[model samples]
Target: MRISVVIPAHNEEAYLPRALGAVAAQTLKPLEVIVVDNASTDRTREVAEAHGARVVLCARKGVAFARQAGLLAARGEWVAMTDADSLPTERWLERLTARAGGAVALYGPLRFYGVSPFEATLSEQGYRAFLNLMALLGRPNLAGANMMLLKEAALWVGGFPEVEAREDVLLGWRLRRLGPVRYVPEALVLTSARRLQGGWGPFLLRQVRNLLGDPRGYFGEGGERER
Candidate 1:
């Protein structure tokens, strides 16, 4: 099956090359690599084009908009989504494709990288514990940085919801109704821990607020789902 890798970038010139390199080195190569430049002020477009990736410029400034644009442009049987700052393992695509059967959507694990020792331990342990608890309750929150979806399945859900945050979770819920979403732990992606640079206290607090349905803290005031 043909797989298209879509990367949403915004001022990510410094990291785009590495992410694209990882894609090039994948054991199971993707049919195409698309970089959606989300109104970046930096050299994101130039870097992506330099890496031989097809760059699509999205005038909108949100990740969701960029992702939807890429999906619309994708011509592969399956679409894999990853952030500009994240890097997949050599076997990432191979593992995802292996697990794609019998499911409409697939999600893998995301590991935090480029962090201080203290921050890394805390972030990793905290998230693992939180996910374990959620699993026990039969609730799973999917991460966009390590997700794959069939093109038909994505179209059935009307594409991703153009929200500033938690779009992955919202879309996962919708896709789950159409078919099962398989979790493949072996297909891991390395994501930057820059969010922890702001301190875990504030980060965890914001996550808590968001989980509690505080729309202001999660999606901002009056932030409804976009078409």
Candidate 2:
């Protein structure tokens, strides 16, 4: 199936290049690379264009809206979603597509870059445990940074809700109702540790809060400023 990789970016001038470069390096290259510029005041559009990514403008201020815009514009049979601050492994796309095997969606592990080794290990292990638990409950543990889904499946779920956080997880839950959501442990993506600026303790606490209740982790800070 043809794949379109969509990246929802907001003021990601500092990190867009790395994200785009990783897409370009994918073993199974995408049919198209789309970068949804979410009202970025920075050079996000220009940078995306420079990397040969089609720039889709979303004046709306949230990642959810930006993602919906990209999904609407995407023409590929499958959609690969990643954040502007994340770096997919060279074989990320190839592995995901290979393992799709009739599944409607796929999600994998994430390893944070620019973080201490101890922190990375802890976070990775914790996330894996969470994924396992969710699987037991017939729910999906999907991260926007490393997920692939059928474009038709995403549209069927009404795209992503215009919420501040947990939109990825919400989308996954809806998709699961239609068909299987595959887990790919080796198709890892390296994401920015910028979110941990306040230190690991608070960052982790905020993550739990995001998972348990409303997501005040990422979008609550006003989309553009944080990304």
Runs of candidate 1 exceeding 4 Å displacement: 206-227
Relative to the true structure, how large is the alpha-carbon lDDT of every model?
0.80, 0.85
Position 64, candidate 2: lDDT: 83
In model 2, pairs of residues that clash are none
Which candidate wins on TM-score? Answer: 2
Model 2: number of backbone collisions: 0
TM-score of each: 0.87, 0.89
Model 1 is weakest, by summed lDDT over 10 consecutive residues, at: 217-226
The pairs that clash in candidate 1 are none
